[model samples]
Target: MSDKEIVEPLIPASGSQKIDSATKRGRIQMILLLLVCAAPVIASYFTFYVIKPAGGKANIGELVSPVQPFPSNVIEENLVGKWTLLVARPASECKVGDDACVTLLHVMRQLRTAMGKERTRVQLVWLVTDDSVIDPEIAKSYDKELAGFTFIRMPRDLAKKQRLMTWLNADNEQSAIHLLDPRGDRMMRFKTGEGHLDFKKMVKDLEKLLKWNPTGKVGD
Candidate 1:
């Protein structure tokens, strides 16, 4: 046998390995993007839930555990961009009077107004749960142009309507005023009192939220 040295050839990386590496990179980038988008929301929650100011009491509005994301089938574009205070009532019940339905509407309107200049950052949404004709006076009073209110009719489709009801009545308090963040998550619920509604506490909670989660634009 001749004294010849045998050398092994170096192997190149396999296609599968390259693909796995690329996929990992893509996933990492996506995760980072999500974190960036969620940072403000996370920070606000942390401030409200974890770092309580001295003598600061718990939130007046009950926090919806795990939070309910706004149903995409139900006026999603309107809800997603701004902080929303939502109330659900049938048009038949929301007449121009001092009824519970009208009271809730007033509460939502005042809550937004209390924000002052930051009022524009908030949106009042009245979800009419039925096809009953809205009172013309009520409509005139809450005109979108003047009062900055957006009225959305409940989805006609049975499935879509059910999903919305499930979210709105998560606590079985369908008449409560719900709070939705800019990202469209229903995080808080304010229930009615004995023939009254506490406007001050609600204003405090809303102010804290606006202070902590200030956004420059509608969708920001």
Candidate 2:
């Protein structure tokens, strides 16, 4: 019998193995992109929350825990482009019965003026929570006094109004002024009593926020 040399055949990887490797590479790339995009947001949170300046207090306005989303159904604009000062009060509060709104509006206007050249970058929004039409005289007063104010209507139902109110925290029934970052996250609020709105404190707080956050773009 003739002697035959023994030989072994080389085997190539299965198609499934090549596909799995490609999928893994794609997933890694996606994860890296997500991290890159999210780095700034994470850093901002760290700087604002975890890192603190020695001997200095945080912002004057009460910072809302776990920032709330802006109610888009009320304001169609993204509201993310400029620092927004939101005045949230029910229209019923504005009925001829309530006189506090006058002082509230005045305080809000002064707060904006205190911003100096930065005023244009700050958007003032008045969120009315009831379906009741604003009294004509009051509407005209707003037009004449509060220039460039954005008026919006909140949900009419009491329950729905409560849900929207959850966006900002307040201790009492009195009207409150809220601050929204350029990104439109409800961040802080300034509560006020009948006629005792503190314009100076609010001004100081806003100046500090502007100095820290700035406009242009996030992290710029």
lDDT of 1 by residue, 157-192 (tens): 889888888887776888788888878888788887
Model 1: C-alpha RMSD to truth? 4.4
Candidate 2 wrongly placed segments (more than 4 Å)? 1-59, 95-97, 144-146, 155-174, 194-196, 216-220
Task: Count the clashes in each prediction.
Answer: 0, 0
lDDT of each: 0.80, 0.66
- Clashes by residue pair, model 2: none
- lDDT by residue (tens digit), candidate 2, 68-101: 6675554454577777777877666775546687
Alpha-carbon lDDT of model 1 = 0.80
Cα displacement (angstroms), candidate 1, residue 137, comes to 1.5
Residue pairs in candidate 1 whose N, alpha carbon or C atoms collide under 3 angstroms: none
Output the number of the TM-score-best candidate.
Answer: 1
